[model samples]
Target: MILGYFFILGNTNCTAQSLPFLPDELTQVLESGLPKTLPSPAETGRFKKLPAGDGFVWLAESTATLKKGNKLAFSKTFDAPLKEDDVGFVAVRCRIVDADNNANEPRPGRVLIHIGDRETLRQTALYHKGTIGREWGWYFHPFRAARSLAANTGRIRLSFDVQPQRVEIEDVRLYVAPSGFDMSRLPMMEAGYQGREPDAPWRQGADARIAKYRTAPLIVRVLDPHGSTIQQADVRIRMRRHAFGFGSTFQVRLVDDISPDAIRYRQTFEELFHALVPVPALIPQHTPHAKDGNYANQLLSDLTNTLHWAHDRRLPMRG
Candidate 1:
């Protein structure tokens, strides 16, 4: 999300203001598909209505007891078929609880979306063990519409596959945006630990520490052989690398490939980053013939080439 800043400067005074903008182009879809109230009295299926204060706190929500290999489907129909370039956004506030109430253990699950009879889009679990606690949390998923499903039909289906567990769904929301819309600009849950709020007491000290330790004043001076400063000399300072490690896993093959795309990828990586960690090609576990010397030698060659390439461009390798 882009945070807007406005600055007012004067000879002796300056002020700055931060304004956050929320886009208005997004349209909500699939509202009818969501369960408004707990399923009706006569409702009978895998999903059952659960009232508030029943081991959880929600005005009303739906709970589904899913077994291994079982699937629960929720379908919605749009007034018009989605365009091929449209983007879909999903926000689900849900939590999965094991039958034995073991919140510490990781639970495996999958969420899938099907448009008409076209291909299915798979997503990983809604919440991991680290994020899952006694309360429900929101999870966001953004997807693109495939060309085959575009203008085919107005029906969209959501499927949930869970291990033997009880899944509590507090809310589900869907939105659609134009193809070029920036998904990162969409609103999402803020992730942080305790004492991260704007008014938190710890923030003042944290900001002070950052200002004192993370930044410094830079002074450049030009001197002559006579031990006198050259007052008229021009000085330029350019940062060649970062003081901190800011890097990502890069594909080793792409560094030396002749393909146009690979060359562009390497150029972009070098332009934007100062360090890298080579992926599978240099990783020992991914080496197939670890016991044999041939594969080991090849990996060593790739590593040597990568190190030379990085060194030529002043890029540091983490591992």
Candidate 2:
């Protein structure tokens, strides 16, 4: 993530993504947006919803067992919809608003999008990092139109892949490339031709040279909105990619957990390591440790060797 890649999803239109208004809290959590261009679930029926959040937002999906499944679909409700913007990412929140922990299986969740004819989904896994008092951040693939599902009023669905999980989601948002603002318009557009997939993302050669010894090479440094540093927090990412059908993963040691109370984590397997936070820090804004809600956004930004990546498609860090 770069300075620009990081825009409060719910708060601003940093990345040219087409999204509905973002609720205040969500912007307090993650930055950037992901989009979906999938099939028109509206073809079946209208979008579904139940009372939630101040007035209305889809109910978060919850499963009774990590074994069973729960899902809900929402229809396009924009009084007036936007056009063919290219989506790069979708950002949303998820947490065990309520839970009956029969197992440590991470509660499952998602940020799903439906276009007229196709569908793109950003799957959420159990919490890998971050505090429970605040919603954890998850980034999925950008909304794609390449193999996109068509239409305006499609479906927005969420599901619980496993059971014994009750998750809450809010501040659904997106990162889009307005349908007509074709990057082809950029004078340097020819340099970005080799698109990327989720798994084996392109790593610049020089960046590879810089990461010569590490097993995973891309390292980013996150700064707070006021431009302060977050010290010693672990950095991890779950991103949906276009190269492969599913998505990709990346991680690095950010900081040591100071509190003895531990957060059980479901590890991710990232083979094409593209980024890391050379220095990860956090300003613990709360009390008796985990109970505090006082904290700043996890300063996260992307580290890239654009020059090299522009020439190659690889995650330079993985040895």
Candidate 3:
């Protein structure tokens, strides 16, 4: 299977995406001063204390087990009165770990989210990669309106119908979109080589092309803070080539792991692929590495080809 991905470099007033999982780590890579529209688990104050008044804080990655027919449930009521802004959309994150000797693979489990007396929605907490021994992944559930529920005292509940097995529940929290909030206004990310679901088709196409060809020419026109284009500008470009392997199945995963180990690999690529790298003296013609070029002439050629291609396709190629 052929995999693809791309990065975006544009001038626009855009914020970063709200990645609840270690957002601080992501923020380091992302731009600053960007708004995080998603509400935090602390904002809800649902897991503040225990009912027994023992001052036990309900932590994430809590463990639980269930028989084949048994169902496990957990719920939280909103402390502050719900406002008009909390009515449109709702999202939450959940994870489940399977521990059992009888099964070699993971199975699908049932997840029910109770919005209120009127809405009791049902969804599946699918295993990671559809396998059974150990599974972990992000689970985002979207709902229509929390306003109706908020109108009636403002409370939310979550339920899990566990399959016959040992399951460990991870951190879970709910969020409601602001009033008159439009999802389209949300900041967008360039769908990388291995994009998650709910991707923008236009971006996906552009990203796919960049991934396959492994190169694209972009004319960087600098602009003042007031949006005026500057004639003289010094621009820099960063390019990186990635290699991913898949053996078990023909399904190609882009392997966009951003862990600490992968950081060094990414950094090496960034350094090697720096567009401003001076030409090496080894080659008489100043030829760059054909595999991943850094020579000025090679870059100019790529830019020329890109401009010609864009012109042929009637795509705007602004200088």
Best by TM-score: 1
Instruction: For candidate 3, write residues 1-319 as lDDT tens digits.
Output: 1111122222111112233232111112112221122122321121222222332222222134444422344444443333422322223332333323365433333344555532332221111111111233333433334223434344444444333333333334445555444433222223222223355346878888877796556778789999999887877776433242111210001123355544564344333432221212222332334223323454446445544533453334222
What RMSD does model 3 have? 22.3
Top-down TM-score ranking: 1, 2, 3
TM-score of 1: 0.41
Tell me the tens digit of each residue's lDDT in model 1 across 1-319: 3232221111111111111234677776666325453433212135565665634322222134344332455555554445543566565565544322343433322344554433332321111221222234545545545432434345555454332345555555667776577655654333334343477667889989989998899987889999899998977788876787778888775666686767898888877787899875656544535423443465666767788998998787886
Model 1 regions more than 4 Å off = 2-22, 33-45, 52-70, 99-134, 188-319
Q: Write the per-residue lDDT of candidate 2 for residues 1-319, one digit (tens) a residue.
A: 1112232212221122223333232211113222233223322122224455454433333333332322334323211223333333344443344333563332223333433421333211111211111144433333333223333433344443333333444445443444444332221100111123233334566458746754455577878889898788678976554243232222212222222221121122223333322222221321124222212122222113222332253333321
Model 1 poorest 10 in a row by lDDT: 9-18
lDDT (CA) for every model shown?
0.52, 0.32, 0.34
Model 3 stretches astray by more than 4 angstroms: 1-71, 80-94, 99-104, 108-110, 117-137, 184-319
